[model samples]
Target: MQNQKTIITVTGYKGGVGKSTTAVHLGTFFGSRFRTLLVDADPNRTAVSWSKRGSLPFQVADERQAFKLINEAELVIIDTPARPDSDDLKELAKGCDLLILPTKPDIVSLEPMLEMVKDLGDANYRTLLTVVPPYPSKEGETLQKELSEGGIPVFKTMVRRTVGFERAAMAGVSVRDVDNRFKSAWDDYVSLGNEILELLNK
Candidate 1:
């Protein structure tokens, strides 16, 4: 690992937004290329359980052990719980190279995400639109426009809502091991990882 370690925190105010899934898959993807550590900061321990059940090669750290892993790993991905406030977000935002907020296209999910963006108060962090439908829908387009006008940086590639993701999760496998239908999802995640790398390089 020649590059300096980069920290990425995945947060959202609402549950079922695919935060843990993103953390697991992204960690596995990057771990293949870099010495990555996945930190399960959420009290729920969903990521920790998933990794144990999936039997992944990556390591998981609790709050107490996270700093040590952060100091040692080439990359750290922190998976946070839902509904974290400004102060909480700030604490996690410190030393982070990138902050990824995953949200669905519906209004219920978008409102809190907007509040999170305001809380972050930094323009460099990236917002990822997750659980999007396969085809372009009216709601997805509208939400995309709202985010863009608000000056939030959102990735053009989106993760579609599919059973493949759920199935992979249950089996403790990543999208990388899933079928071809999810190839685009894997690519989108890789692209986001690449974007984070680019930002860190800058």
Candidate 2:
């Protein structure tokens, strides 16, 4: 496809922050418009397992295949191992067009993400808030404001926690493609995908 090549690396200090899931859905978003590859660089192989369960719209490759497949796709999303050391994060920041650090709103996720941000040191990155509890709770907004005020780059879109993601995972499909009940969850990612595109264009 004519889509500009963009390598996006998704990583965080903790698992279960939806890092792989974000990579998968972003792959889906870009793949639908341009050729895309999702690389399972995580030892847990969450993306591999998820793709194996059912057909994903895009290609899923183990880290070993990344070098070969990366050139063949217009968009590449790498799901990295959790807790990459400062050196690795620095190198990773220099390599990818965008380094996405997914963080949940809870303290458990917040602390490590904060530490990871500190280690990044001027990396071309943005913090993506994930697994946000549904309304009536302002945790996501609160944290986003805090981080932004602190001069950290944070995405405007937040991925809300939903069982639809679990359902989509079981079926190995993009959240929006899986069911209508989880439209909001999918919408969140759609917004994120758009924001990413806009950011890249800038």
Candidate 3:
């Protein structure tokens, strides 16, 4: 099969929505299968830091050099900065094969995500509900319904809130390394990865 380059951008309009986490894990997952390049566009450089500490097998570049990195790899994953309303985001989105908006299952997180979706201007994107509580409360269901009604594609699989995630973050490891208590979260990430690949194929 001919190698087709796929560029996936993870963005959020708010901070602490797990944008870097998703970018890193997805890059690692896809890298296991393909030649992947991860671009850390956030000024914070959280993804680059984590990759360095974790010794992840991926290339990292600043926002200015990310486009060149994207051109050189078969798969490019861009991790945008939190609350970014800049022209750089627009330029990155323009080249994306899929745009993933990772949001926590709460109003504070959902609101800005909606705004970012609006700013995206009808691009093909999906909402990934992260940091979801184990047994979703009524509010969680309500938020999910609202997003669906707003014409956003929300994934059925959710990433549950867990200390393991934090631990993995501190250790610069993916949730795949988390213990049995977070098996579901790991599976959800795997499912998300599959969904992403399917979307790219389409």
What TM-score do all the candidates reach, one by one? 0.89, 0.96, 0.87
Q: For model 2, what is the alpha-carbon lDDT of residue 12?
A: 94
TM-score of 1: 0.89
TM-score of 3: 0.87
In lDDT terms, how accurate is model 1? 0.79
Alpha-carbon runs more than 4 Å astray in model 2: 1-4
Which 10 residues in a row give candidate 1 its minimum summed lDDT? 193-202
Please say which candidate is ahead in lDDT: 2 or 3.
2
Q: List candidate 1 stretches off by more than 4 Å.
A: 1-3, 136-138
Query: Which digits, one per residue and each the tens of the lDDT, describe model 3 over residues 1-202?
Result: 0367878989888888888888888877787787788888788998877766666756777777776766668888888777767465566578888888899987788778777776777677788888777673655566778888877888765667777767777777777775777677677778888887676673
- CA shift at 192, candidate 2, in angstroms? 0.2
Name the top lDDT candidate.
Answer: 2
Residue 164, model 1: Cα distance from true site in angstroms: 1.5
lDDT of 1 by residue, 104-171 (tens): 98878888888888877763577788888767566666677778887888766566777777877777
lDDT of 2: 0.90
